[model samples]
Target: MASTPAPTSRRRTGATRERQSTHEGFLVHKSGRWIKISAALAAALILLYIFVPLPPHHFGSSWLGYTLGTVGALLILWLTALGMRKRAITPGRWSLKAWTSAHVWLGVLLIVIGTLHSGFAFGWNVHTLAWALMMIVIVSGIFGVTAYATLPRALSANRYDAEGAITEKQMVEALRSLDRQLHDAAQPLDRECAILVDHSLEQDPFTGSIINRLTGRYPGDATREAASELRRLRAHRPRVADDPLDKVDALLTRKEAMLARLRRHLRIKGWLQAWLYVHVPMTFALIAALSAHIVSVFFYW
Candidate 1:
């Protein structure tokens, strides 16, 4: 008979528990079958809506094919709502991933069924406008899905820390180190202005909303302003031949490069974020358009 030894350390036991929990959380579990079933049902419904004939189905005046068309349109609206509801929350069992998959495929279904529901009828009217809006909504949703799939993970990775929190603290600490070096070097460079310029760059001339970050259209005339200060300070002073000061400038340049990279990483993070402005607004507009279309169908019929 043999008995296995247990984990000898509390840390090891805790780590094992954490891994087990994460593995359970990430398991395929029940979603695969449910997703397949939903996809199949949605596909079948789309096909039936497009091809099936219905009579005594008054759109507004004639309760014939229009009746079945209304059903399909409502179904799409319902599916789209599921996506909207899931937007503000984390992806759980009907997670963002599932909602996105459903939104994309169902949107494709909308194109086929919505067009059929219209019976090839389109004119320059509010009715047609709504259909146009739905198309825009669906396209923007694809952008949303793409952004979520790609950017967030990268942003977390660029933090260079595994806990998944991207902190501005790293940038602050880097700048502080650069400032200390710049201060010690400035006195030797023949004036303090050179050091001040270095300080200002570390301060990052940019700030505020997502657009400003994405555009890199930083505020203030820092470059010209700093150069002006340098000109004033250097006017009559003999050029310093200190190798140590030159080395300081070189070190500052390296710090500048690091700051630029942080900004670039922030800019990429901004692009991933800003598209949602278009995606969300367009979705709201689609609901409005689809609603108008539904109303018009009943009103005209």
Candidate 2:
């Protein structure tokens, strides 16, 4: 005779299952605590901006304006430290996940803080330049956040097939295997057909412009063109069993399918990386403009 499990054991097993099923993305880390804090900070700044009296033209001279400017500057510096934090992984209250959540929400808070600090002043000066650059950095950050949150699922889906998930190395090996098979299969093909197959084999799968990678459009794809031309030539030939062109055509079609999956993987991976090229450079530029703005203000005052 066997004994049944206790009720407490059953409840514990269910709880463990529940925990395993719940996934917490960076956006919703700690149940969106950072989002709530950011909202509160922005609201406080807005209230201060409304209640505190200042000269109509006061942009940086007033105490409140200077205070807001200081806060915004410190926030920008802290947000920029996230890149450094990524290299050193740690756990606890200030984990990387919490840092990222705060980075995103607090970076958004800058729009209100910077605007209030400027006092609605705009002109053809370094002050305005800093503001514009800040806007660009924030916008690019938003795009990056969106990409990270969404595109990862797409990348994962791209790697999966009926059998299992394919790794990058496996993708490369699969293509090489297909190319070798193609090489052997093309031997009995006619001279013109052989040339086309050779072109497909020799062409590099990874060579493409950034635009082509991001857009997943390779207009001059050698493999695709070769497959199309072979099919066209095959159309005019009478149907025959074990024809060499038939084997070659089928191999080309498989290679095309593999190439498409590889390119899609590259496209998603490219999108994941492309935003940093704009965001990182613009961040440094913003810092430079901010330094100039600060210097000119104190120099004149």
Candidate 2 ranges with C-alpha deviation above 4 Å: 1-22
Candidate 2 local lDDT, 187-238, one digit each (tens):
9988999999999999999988999999999998999999999999989999
Cα-based RMSD of the predictions, in order?
6.9, 2.7
Top lDDT model: 2
lDDT, candidate 1, 1-301, per-residue tens: 8765565676789999777645442122244444465467657756765565543243223343455467656766676576457657674667655555555666655665556555555789776787677677667766766776677777767676444544667766766677676666665554465655654555553555666688755555354455455555556566766655455545556565556656767787777877777767876777787777678766765
CA shift at 192, candidate 1, in angstroms? 10
Name the 10 consecutive residues with the lowest summed lDDT in model 2. Answer: 17-26
Task: Please report how far candidate 1 places residue 22 from its true position, in Å.
Answer: 6.4
- What is the total number of backbone clashes in candidate 2? 0
Whole-model Cα lDDT of every candidate shown, in order: 0.61, 0.92
